[model samples]
Structure formats: C-alpha cells, structure tokens
Target: MKDESLIFGTRAIIEAITANKSIDKLFIQKGLQGELSRELMSLVKKNNITFTYVPVEKLNRLTRNNHQGVVAYISPIDFYDLENLVMNVIESGKTPLFLILDQLSDVRNFGAIIRTAECTGVDGIIIQKKGGAPVNADTIKTSAGAVFKIPICKVDHIKDAMFYLQGSGIQVVAATEKAESTIYDTNLTIPSAIIMGSEGKGISPSVLKLVDQSAKLPMYGDIASLNVSVACGVILYEAIRQRL
Candidate 1:
C-alpha cells in the first residue's frame, strides 16, 4: 500500500478516481467534513468503490504519515477485454471451454474455480468486475499458481459475457439445482461456457434466460447443495471426462 505510486494524497486520490483507476477500496476518517471530503464521497459512490468510515485512530494506525483522510487500495490483476480473449482462443484452433462466475464474491471459491477450470482445460474464465473478488495475493495463493497460467477475463456484466459467448457460437450451460437435467446427462463436448452462480442468490434471472442449456449436479445425501467451488470442480471435470 506504501509504494508511493499506490498511496495517494487527497488531491491525488481525487485525480486517480477521475482517471478511472481500478481502486480496490477506500478508507476515510470518521466525522471528517469538508467540500473535498464531500466530493470524494460522491466520487466513491459514483465509482462503486467500497469505503469504510473509521475513527482517526484507525487511520493513524493504517499510516502514520499524512493520509489526508483517505486511502485507496489498488487492484492486483490487470483486466483483459472479454471479446479479445474469446477471439484469441477461437483463433487458436481449439474448442472453447469457458467458466463464468455470476457474482461469486468468495476469494477462495474464485481461486478454487480457477484451479478446477485450469485442470479441466477451460479456455478462459469470465467474471464481473465489481461483484466478484479481486485477483489479489490471496486469490493467487489459493489458486496455487493456476491463476498465472489460466486466462481470466473481467467484464462489466455477466450477461454481456453470455451474449458474447452466444454470438461467438459457444453454447451457454448454466449449473443450477433448479435445472431439469443432471450434469452427467448434459452434453459438454460442444463449444460451451459453463456458468455457476453465487451460493445465496444462484444465477441471476437475466443470465439464466441467456443460457442455451441448464443442468444440475445430483445430490444423494440430505444436504441441499454443494459449495460453489466444489460444484464447479464436479461440473468442470464432467466436461473433461466428456472431452477426453
């Protein structure tokens, strides 16, 4: 956080926000009031940067130097263009296999999904920019170096990824408990993108409608559903089984 370039003063933070830097989050001293503070808060709200209002003591602990009532965490991963990634994969002369995470914010879950997708030979992983976990050190650690080798594309919306996949001739296969067919019965050899939803809400309805096929993982025990990462492993390995 103290890399000089990463740590910014009040004016610097405002400039970075205006420049559209990918800030991970923001921290502001509690009860601080001024025109500049108001503008910063407005900018944070408009840019969707998570902010925590804390006591001055907390800010002091964060940085003894002059923080000017604000600090922003810079993102670790550089995002790529989803369309460009899809096109590159297609041009490489391989059947496309993509995994899309719909609002899956858990870092370990995201990392585990990346590991599974890499092991299963998925062409790419698509995630939404804001709702999902940032590709931070924890994600890289949890992914066990898989994140370095795998291609991950972050987009503004999950539905945009689905539409692009469909336009590129990749069938959208959504994994959900509400689906009629089981994952085992679903065909996976075709060029496809598999989407797994967040644990609580499941896949968003708009994305669900864009899917060409929907299948669920079977459950024999009394437990209703699997963890998002575990379910991702099962479905991705099913695709690997089919392709092999």
Candidate 2:
C-alpha cells in the first residue's frame, strides 16, 4: 500500500472531500465531538461520502499520526459514470461487455474479477457505492495493476445499474447455480453484463428478479459452489469463446 493512500485529520479530510477526492471509505471516532468535527460531518453529508464510526483504537491502527479522530483511504483510481460509459461504448460501435458485482465482500475476489474483465475486453465494471469491496490497496494489489486499465463505475444501487443496462439493450446475466441453463447455453456474444454475487449468499433475491437472464456453471461433483473469482473467470472466458 502506498503511504499517500491514507489521509487523516478532520480538516484534511474535509478538504479532500471538497476537492472531490475518491475516498474508498472513512473511519471516524465513535464519540468524536468538536466544531471541526461538526464541519466535517456537514461536508460528508454534502458529498454523500461513505463512512463508519469506529473506536479510537481502530483509527490508531489505520494511522499512527495525529488523525484528529478521522482516517480516510483514498481510492487509487477514478470511477467512470455508468450512463456516460454505456453511451460512449454504444456510440463507439462496439458491443459493450460489462460486469456487475452484487455486494461482493472480498477485496481479492473483486480484484481478480477486475483483472479478468480487463483481459477479456470488458467495457466497464459496475458496483454499488455503498456495499461490496472498495478499490483499496488489497484490491489494487490483487488486480495486478489491471484496475488502472479498466473503467469501474460506482453507482448508488445495483438494481439501478441493471435497469439502465437493460434499457440500453444490454442484458444482465446473473451467475448462480439456480439457473436451469449453464453458461454454455447462454448467449454471451451479445451486449451483456454478468452479475456475480457475494461469496456466501448468492445474488440478492430482489436483484435476481431484475436480471435479463440467469446462468450457472456445470456441477459435476458434490461441491456445488466455486470461488467467486474463479467462477467469474470461467464465465467470462465462456463469453469469449462464444464471441470467437
């Protein structure tokens, strides 16, 4: 992790928010109270920043410097606007391929999926801003620098992105074992975004209802589930194979 990835102190964080820095997440002292803290809270609300209240010990673990009861992890990459990216891809005459992560919690899985997305020529990746993994140091490390090569959009909700993709003629395909059809049976050559759920829970029921299609990988053994990253790579390559 780079040293600059973290920035503490209430004033510095406020300034970063005002400057529109992409903060992955923020940790604030549980019972922090001060005029500067009040100002910082105002800025956080104004910018709709994602943050959580934590113990002072957690803040200390994040940084040893004088944090003034706040610590922020800066995102290493700039996120793309989902609608704009979709429009750009459509206008460019290329069949847009995307990946939508549904509250995926593992940073390494997110990173590996990103690397695969870049390698397979995915147009962009979409994730909800509030949940799932942030593109922090662990994400960047596992992505093997591919995070810089791809455009990742952070939307407010997964369903919103799914609706937008469907409206724009892109199919949302959910990767889960519940599907009657396997990835080989699905048509991946078309404009589509494959949605992978979290490691434990499959796709959320509300979200599963909205996808254009649901797909599953073949289950030959007693083990029914594959790691999310490995499953993502498998499905993506299946798409590639179909396209080829």
Candidate 3:
C-alpha cells in the first residue's frame, strides 16, 4: 500500500530474481496452478527467496491493479562480497575495522548501527544470511543514507565469518553483557572485527567461542543492557578513540 511497498508483475518479479536484486519477500496468490507458477517456484527455491502464498483477495488488497497473483518487496540496499571487501581494505595498507551482527533482527537498530559504523570509519558490516533484518527503505532512511556509503556483507553463518576474519589476521571481538572485561579496558587498536548480537539473546555460544576477545559495556543503571544500536555506538566510538 505504501510507496515503499511495491508490486511487480510476474515477468518483472522473475527479472528481479534473475538480476539478483535485493528482495525482502515475494507473495503469490494461493492455488495458482500453472506451468509458469512451477517455474517461478523453482526459481524461488534456487535463489532462496522468501515468499508467501496468500489468497487472491489478499493480493488484491496489496495492489489494486492486476498483480498476476505475484508481487515482491524489493530491498533498498545492496550487499557486498565479504572476502573481497576485506582484501581491498588490507591491500589499502590500513587497518580494517569490521562489525559483525549475530542474529540481529531489529531493522531500526541495525540502521542505527550502520549510521554509527559509517561515522566511526568502520570498513564494513557483516551479517548472517538468515535471522537478520531485511535491508529496506526504513533501514536506508534510518541510516541517513549511510547504507549506501558503508559496505554490508551477508554471510552464511557468524562462525564462518569469524573464521575468515581470524584467518585473514583480523582479531574477532565479541561484544556481550556476559563478558568479564569492559570495553573501556579492552584493546581495540589492532585490526579487528566486532560482533554485536541480537537485542534479546546475546551472541551465539558458537560464535562467542570463535572470538579472539570478549568485552562488554559497563552498566550503571537499572536496566541490565542498552539497546543494541546504542551499545554499538559506545563500543565503535571507543575503538575510534583508541585508534586516534
């Protein structure tokens, strides 16, 4: 209904899939039995596109015009290749500062962190392919267009990302409330990657184990933790402070 939400015909949707466009989700009217529908389903499966089968009435509600029982939500931001971005950063003869999000699902929080990460000169942001917020217009607006300026790498898993970063000579630091050390005391001057977890659960145990170091922000208030985005700012700026 909103301008941010767009509807595409079946051919346009297929073109989007073929073009590797960032798609948040796709919708197909339920019980649309056809050869073209089978091909669409095959493409969706191949591309790992998230889609929902809904009643034709719901499709009509989404768009007044003929949607051909198909519509897709396109994402505003483009993802980067993690390994290439890292290699480029290293080849530039500068220390790489990467931020990794472990299962962070809140869209606004993610946007806020991108804004901070960009300001702090973070080289890139890494997020898991699944269990993360879809990058949409809200993220772009909330980031104040930082999403365009900063590189975001979507990875298959957090642990795999940690492994690659570590193997590449960057220290992997896990930010968690459970850490024994405070971020203020930890050393961040080295080329490093920081992992920020979800709002509810902290970093996954498997991921935490792979980190080179674990640190947390000191809590002095009644609340046990700060919002993920707020914590990201404190930690990232602290890194910037330490580097400068």
Candidate 4:
C-alpha cells in the first residue's frame, strides 16, 4: 500500500470526504467517540462510504504517525455511473456486455477479471461499494494498468445492479458450478452481463435469483472449481468468440 493512497487523521479524512475524494474504505479505531467522530460518522452515512472499526493496533500498523483513530484508503481510479454507462453503450450502437462482480475481494483476481474484460471489450464492470475489492496499487499492477482502461461502476448492491441491467434489456447470466448448463450453451452475443462471485461463497442466492440464465465451465479434473480469474477469462472469451 502506498502512503499516497491513504489519508490519515479524523480531520484529514473529513476534509477528503468533503472534497469528494474517491475513498475506497475507511478505518476507525474501535470505541472512538467524540464530536469529530460523530461528525465523521454523519459524513460517512451521507456519502454512503464503507467503513470498519478496528483496534488501535491496526491503526498503528498502518501508520506510525498520529492517525487520530482514522485512516481512509484512496481509490486509484474513479468509478462510473451505471446508468450513464449503459446509455452511452446503447447510443454507440454496440451491444453492451457488462461484468458484474459479487463480493470479489481478492485484489489479484479482481485485477485479472478487469484485464480480461478490457480485452473482451466489455462495456463496463459493476461491483458493490462495500464488499468488492479496493482499486489499490496491487490491483493496478496485477491488471497491467488495464484497471484504468476499464469503466468500473460501484453500486450499493449487486442485486439492484442486476435488476437495472435486466430492466435495460440485457440478459444477466451467472457463472456457477451448480448450474447444469455449460457456458457454451448460454447465448452471449446479445446485450448481456455476466455475474462472477466470490471464491468462498459463489453467487449470493438473492442475486442469483434475478439472473436470466446460469452457466458453468465443465470441470473434469480432481479439483472441484477453477480459480475465479481463470473462470472469468473462460466465460468472457466465450462471449468474445460468439460476437466475433
């Protein structure tokens, strides 16, 4: 983590928020209470920023400086508005192909997915504001700077995003091993969005319920599942192959 990507101290974090800086996540010391803390909390609620309360040791580990019970990670890339992105793609006369990620926290996997999405000419990538991986230095490096080339949108919830995509006439397909059909069976050449979930919990049941279709890669080996990034590549390229 680079020091340039962090804003420390209560007042500093508050100023960053006031300035409308893209904050990936906020960390506050547990049991922190004061007028400043209350004000910060109000701003966090108003801005819908994600935060976590941690021990003082965690703050100390992040920085030896006087952090004043607060640390905010700054996002390297600015997020896009989903509706605007969808409208733009439609206006361009291009079939919109989006990738929606559900609680994918691993930085490397997230980066790899972005890289593949960019190569596949995906219109955008949507993720939850809270549970998704932060666009940090590691993510940028892992993506080979493709993170900057892609339009990534942060939504309040993945389920809501799926609804919006479906409403816009895009088919929402989920990649999960539980599905009986293979990715090759799913038609991806049309306006569509693919939902990739976390490694531990596949896709959330609530979001999966909204998907128009579900498809999976055939696994013949001893391993039950492929890495999330590799699976993402497989599905995205399938879309690319169909479109080509």
Best by TM-score: 4
When summed lDDT is taken over every stretch of 10 residues in candidate 3, the lowest stretch is 1-10
Tens digit per residue, CA lDDT, model 1, 11-96 = 77898889877676677888888998888889888876677787877777767878888876676655567889989989999889
Q: Write the per-residue lDDT of candidate 4 for residues 170-232, one digit (tens) a residue.
A: 999999999999999999989999999998999999988889999999999999999999999
Query: What TM-scores do the predictions have?
Result: 0.81, 0.96, 0.90, 0.96
lDDT of each: 0.84, 0.92, 0.88, 0.92
| Per-candidate RMSD, Å | 3.6, 1.4, 2.1, 1.2
TM-score (C-alpha) between model 4 and the true structure: 0.96
Native-to-model Cα distance after best TM-score fit, residue 211 in candidate 4, in Å: 0.6
Cα error, residue 210 of model 1, in Å, equals: 1.9
Error in Å for residue 119 of model 2: 0.7
**1-244, model 2: which lDDT tens digit per residue?**
5477899999999888888889889999999998999999998888788899999999988888899999998888999999999999999998889999999999999999999999999999999888788888789899999999999999989998998999999999999999999999999988999999999997999999998899999989888899999999999999889988
Error of 1 at 234 (Å): 0.9
Residues 1-244 of candidate 3 have per-residue lDDT tens digits of: 3766575678778888888887777889888878777888899999877678888888788788778889888877778999999999999999889999998988899899999999999999998776788787778889999999999998877888888999999999999988999998888999999999998987988878778899999899998999999999999999999999
Q: What residue pairs are clashing in model 2?
A: none
Off by over 4 Å in 3: 1-5, 29-32, 52-61
Find the 10 residues in a row with the least total lDDT in model 2.
Answer: 1-10
Pairs of residues at least 3 apart in sequence or in different chains that clash in candidate 3 = none
